[model samples]
Target: MDYESLYKLIPKEPKKWLTQDVISWLQFIGLGQMEQKFVECSIDGAVLEDLTEKDLDEELGITQRIIKRKLLNWVNHGLKEYNEYIKQMKMPNLNNKKQQDEDFTIQKNIANSQFEQMLIENHENNGNDQFTSSVVRQEEQAIKQEIPGFNKFEHQLILQPIEGQQSNFYCVREAGAKIGRHSSNQILILEENISRFHAEIIFQDSMFALKDIGSTTGTFIKILKSLTLIQGMLIELGSNQFSVQKLDLLDNGGIEISLFVVEGPNLEDTIIFQLNKDKPSVALGRKSTVDISFPEDHHLSNQHAKFYLVDQTVTIEDHGSTNGSWMRLSGEGKMSNLFYLDPNEEIIIRIGTTNQYICQQNKMKVNEISGENLCIICVERERDCLILPCKHNATCLKCSKNLALCPFCRVKIQETIRIYKN
Candidate 1:
């Protein structure tokens, strides 16, 4: 029999290492000892040239009836564990295929979550590695920023028009915004780094239309018009969501100038700006200042920026944008550009605007690691598992049921137990 098959035949768990079932399995495999030497030898792959029931009994120093009973039990136990593992492994793929057959709506949602996680990890690790704790924190931060506040909606600024500035707006989300006031037309002309901002401008009847700014992060629209049709109303677009019904911008300024949130989501978040109803209005002074860079001094911009406290390690990839990003390792150098990342490095992005894409280096201190308060499910024997916010911890399902408190913290979750499905 294959060693791998045998490995599965025996419980992989150390806690179950010497159970009666396991002993029985060894007996069935002819590894049980009447004399102890046969059992010892069998474990190391050595065996006798000739075999008989008495020989086996002699080898185990046990009676034939006892050996036979243990052997049968061993085979049964091995089969049970094998069947369980097979069932568990097949569930996820089978569920995915079944979801596909059912039109993939739910599967797509799950896929998108996984995809967004991948993209976020790529950004965190600069797209050169898999996710680590540092990378996961960045992704979780991105997710938090994208979908903050579970209950009601929220609004934020995208770009305030910058006038008479000779700055290059790299379509890479962090670039600054440009706004121009056409004196003769009396309209605000807002120009965003087309690469960073995302919008969908629908041309409707030249008078009425809609604008949906799809983004993974988020897009906000604040209408300054009191015409009831377009003023002070906040429009938000989620990933793949839409916005409908609005005015056209053919006549406002040389072009209609309106503020649009840019560079929040991934590539799909960028869309065209379409404003309806072109009206001549004098340039309104910007209520906000125009900066050419993100905040450079934020503490989050530490050299160990990618030190996520969650799953560790990640890869990075640059999208070939101007003003490249970099990673600053602690005690390494002032700042260095990178196309990839190791487990311990931090991340930093250079942008054209005053905003600094600085991420704080989360410490994986002993307290943080040991202070964690949840149940974890460890699946891979070769790798360590992390505990998520859910009450699950790293252990087999069978072991988990016997515990009352969170395994890591000993906090009593008396009436509740979190179950993880494949």
Candidate 2:
């Protein structure tokens, strides 16, 4: 039989005996006597609305497609009845409207008499208007206290700019607050890079979360690392104290790194290096043996610095170069003589006059490198030839044989040198 026909067979007073029992509700909805045992075993204590087709097919041995479909239809009909039953239970009895009206009228009279007495008391106290205003304010506060989800100390999300100058704090009073270029958003960032509705900060279950909402540029959080210092041990960097135990340069795992020369003579330079999983360490230098080599720059030492990732923490130590290295902490514009870095900190490495920005990213983004270590001319073979004078390494040996000028800088190729990788 169809669901509509079976639904008609259910008793009108099923609510009196339903008690949220799945089997009883199914039976009331005209489920067959033979199928009762299977339904009971599958959903012994489930609610009517919670019943799904998958539950019956998987939990019960109901392999027949036609039988399962019919059973699902009946369960859907039962859910509708369950909703109606709940609606009926919550509905006030309109049959006793006259008595309800009388009760409301009596309460209204008592409130009005009390209000009149309060006004009289205020008048007797030398007509103190401030005292009367204070009582009204107190009543408003009491009403606010009775409101659902009202909080005096609402959680706030603070967005500090990368430059470390100013911060925007949002008092999250509702479930969520929008941050975008639009004025309608709770926090409006008026920048060309920001979209109309860039992101949303949601406060749910006493926890705050940020979600990017189809933004063109996308939203990013500056991942901050916590610092732990041992008692009586200090590695001073001007006013800051870094732990000596945390400064072990040989410590190694669990981090990927990307280095970029943010401010330098060559703006196109980018180096992406993944730490060795077994021994999580990377060396930066002018030497060819290092993981990352800056051969063009004379300012960098042969073995400039080393970055270590150990116990889920990242630390950097200088290799004692003639030109000492300096680090710029995250959110700061200026660089400091800090030799070590805490986890999640973005430090600008200054080797002599050259400045390189080192960022510890969640993953290594190789795609960010334009033309990605491949020959620019052929686009098939790896770039093994370095075009000298310009020092542009953007061509293979076969492609470099025909080219007179560098593909990148357009400088005359004094020599075409083939670079061999180990």
Candidate 3:
């Protein structure tokens, strides 16, 4: 429920936030205790922004003066910021029935797929379950074979158009991929705000690295680097997640934060911890050895990710894990064109107003809300390939290449045959 990141993901005029957006903000500001009530009342961003001091006590029943003050302050600040800066970030209508239905489908598919992977991973390789079903052998082999080429794998770049730029994938060879206004670049970004020699996404040391070679506006690649944590950030590591609220800046020169764990059914059974420069690096995973552990979450690797503190800023990095980690990527930051190459992650960067390449599923996962040719899996790119045998035109060339099973029927996919549509 990182509200800022969520807002960055689906930009809208502050007053136009969807219901989901409102829930996220409520959680971030310690107002989540009233989330059920707000949702039951069908309160959306537009309605939330319109609530007044009197309305809070009388209608909303937010009797606490402190709580009422916080709500009013948020509305006033949002209005001030919207009027002074931040354009009407113009994003697609995420609430449309079609869009919501598609999101639900994607969520459903992700859950089912994860469950299938666990079932497959549990099958012993000694042919113990061979006679039971070739399902294990077939799916496991496909996944193993595809894992090697997933990097060389061509994924789509889902651009949420910025006047002139259209969303398209520009595959970067082993050497590197450059993006800018120049026609010679691998990805030609014609946006006026972009510099001529913007930035380069290079594949090095068996991974992708991005470096800005002096751009006027500066290149701000989203994640896979040290991200400065602002107050009220919702950080998620696999199944374990927490909301960090910056408490105060130390007089001696540091920062303190209260980390509140947001999990389980009972809100009353909440857990809170404190973190600061005293703890330089904290490992996070399901293993008891890690600083923070989610023992019950099978999806998390023993050592999944890590958080760091440097110069009053908190940053995060994904450790080498069975499944990669990511967070909501959006908004802006002040970063120079520095080379960023994580041990994990395929190199993908962009120029222009904003790069809508959704964060990988953990957060980096991207999704295209609307488009006639959109892939059913990522839902961001065009449907350009069919699952073998079933031949269902469901996923884009990228997602199609990465699947071990056809998402639609859960059938073991023999191959993804590239197909073109009229």
The models' CA-based lDDT, in order, is 0.29, 0.46, 0.54
Worst 10 residues of 3 by lDDT: 358-367
Q: By lDDT, is 1 or 2 better?
A: 2
Top of the candidates by TM-score: 3
TM-score, one value per model: 0.19, 0.29, 0.31
| Clash total of candidate 3 | 7
Task: Give residue 195's error in model 1 in angstroms.
Answer: 56
Better of 1 and 3 by lDDT: 3
Evaluated with lDDT, which candidate comes out highest?
A: 3
lDDT of 3 at 230: 67
The model with the greater lDDT, 2 or 3, is: 3
Q: After superposition on all CA atoms, what RMSD does each candidate show versus the true structure? A: 29.6, 33.0, 20.7
Candidate 2 vs 3: which has more TM-score? 3
Q: Who is ahead in TM-score, 1 or 2?
A: 2
For model 1, the run of ten residues with the poorest summed lDDT:
304-313
